[model samples]
Target: MTVMTTHLESETAEIKRRRDPFLIILWLVLVVFALLWVAPIVLIAFTALKSNAEIMATNAFTPPETVAWSNFSGAWERGNFATTFQNSVIITVIKVPLGLMFSAMAAYALARIKLRFGKLLLLFFLFGAMIPFQVMLAPIFTLVNGFGLIDTYPGVILPYLAFGVPYQVFILHGFFKAVPKELSEAALIDGASHLTVFRRIFLPISLPVLAALLILDFVSTWNEFAMALVLLQDRNMWTLPLGLMSFQGQFSTDYGQLNAAIAMTVFPAVVVYMIFQRYFVSGLTSGAVKG
Candidate 1:
């Protein structure tokens, strides 16, 4: 009994000695980052509740003496959020799913199906991902103008879909490629067509990745600015970013209302992330490692 107790105590000491300092450093780093990220958001919330006069007098981090609840309503009305919010919602709702579907289909073809010149096509997509959107702005504008799509949702939506697909396809392709070949082979042996396999097997199993992409694509669509600014000439057709831009005038800016609008703009995305966050980490890391 004495010898057994000594061995058990030695094992506990060994385990304690083996505890990595790297984990402690990692957690400390994570906590610091978490606080860093949360600070700006908290500051924005604080500023949003202040009056413009109060904002001008006090520093950004200072809290309001009294919560100015009207700032939210004022932001909604003054920013023309009613119209801009609808336009943003319309673009995001239409663009994200369509982009995901198209990306997923392309990824499936590239990763699962044996296609002619598949490597070349993938390289083409990767090249497209590297090309900056700023470089394409002139050509895209001209193309949209030629199609008479300017001042239209299709104008902006089409461009968004095109730009977003390359990266999304890149992400989904990796995840799809990592799927077990045996699973696909078994399905094929059971008389399942490629399309059937994709729809039934791949799609169901890829929910985490799909949800992750959906959230990412949704936020990108929601916050898109430059293309929307150029394509959507009509004021009523403006999206949230454009609407937010209106807060800054040549001579004067409404900081409080601007911050309020910002808070509101960020709210939907926060809600979306919260809802889909469970799948986010898993989805991103899906194909990162292999046994």
Candidate 2:
């Protein structure tokens, strides 16, 4: 009976020991922030369900009178999402891999090869990264027109590749430099070329950084609007952002349809984040250890 009583007292102490007030407070704070973050999304979802008249007639926080799901299908059709979505997918699919490959190659050379003036060249790329994209629009437009790429896929794609490479190379260079030199030297002694070393040694270890860059580039290219607006003139060639412009009339806007379109357009990037979120922190940090 004494042993049982002692065991009960020990269990109660253990339970109290496991509880921390600061941890509970921290969690409560996090919960508040999380709710604050999700509140916008929830509001947008509710707004998407409302009619245009209902939206203007009621309070912003009011529950939508009806869950008008047709807004999605209507927006899909009226916005011509089929073609715009296709263009975005093609651009993302081609650009992500192409950017990564080229960036990785350039980064490897800059980080590992000891090329003459490599720092100057990296400075050039960093300059490109720092430049205001809006300032480049006129020159880029002229170049695109001069090359006869106006309203074409090449027009849109080339700019993405050019801008995409610098930041990617910047991040990847740090990562490549962080890789131990002896490993590559060992590979070379075993009859491996630089190409083989890159493929077999460097890339395998650099997956997290690469994944983070991939997600970042994918989201940026997918959501790009200003450049797309200037380059693409034909309605048929319009990407998702341009297609959303169709919902805005000079006088009035289709708020329900507009909100629905936004949700759909944002869905892919959100899904990509969810998939790669685990790798993101490690990827961004591990590359910086040696840099």
Which pairs clash inside model 1? none
lDDT of 2 by residue, 1-291 (tens): 211222235777768745846556766877999999988898788888998888898887788998888888888888888999998888889988898999998888888877789999988887777776877898899999999998999898999999988888888888888777898998888888888888888889889899998889989999999999899989888888788776554212777887888888988999998999899888988765445
Report how far residue 60 has shifted in candidate 1, in Å. Answer: 4.2
By summed lDDT, the worst window of 10 consecutive residues in model 1 runs over 1-10
List candidate 1 stretches off by more than 4 Å. Answer: 1-36, 56-62, 250-252, 288-291
Model 2 worst lDDT run, 10 consecutive residues: 1-10
Model 2 off-target regions past 4 Å?
1-26, 51-66, 250-253, 288-291
Total backbone collisions, model 1: 0
TM-score of each: 0.86, 0.86
Model 2 residue 277 CA deviation (Å) reads 1.4
lDDT of 2: 0.84
Task: Indicate the residue-level lDDT of 137 in model 1.
Answer: 78
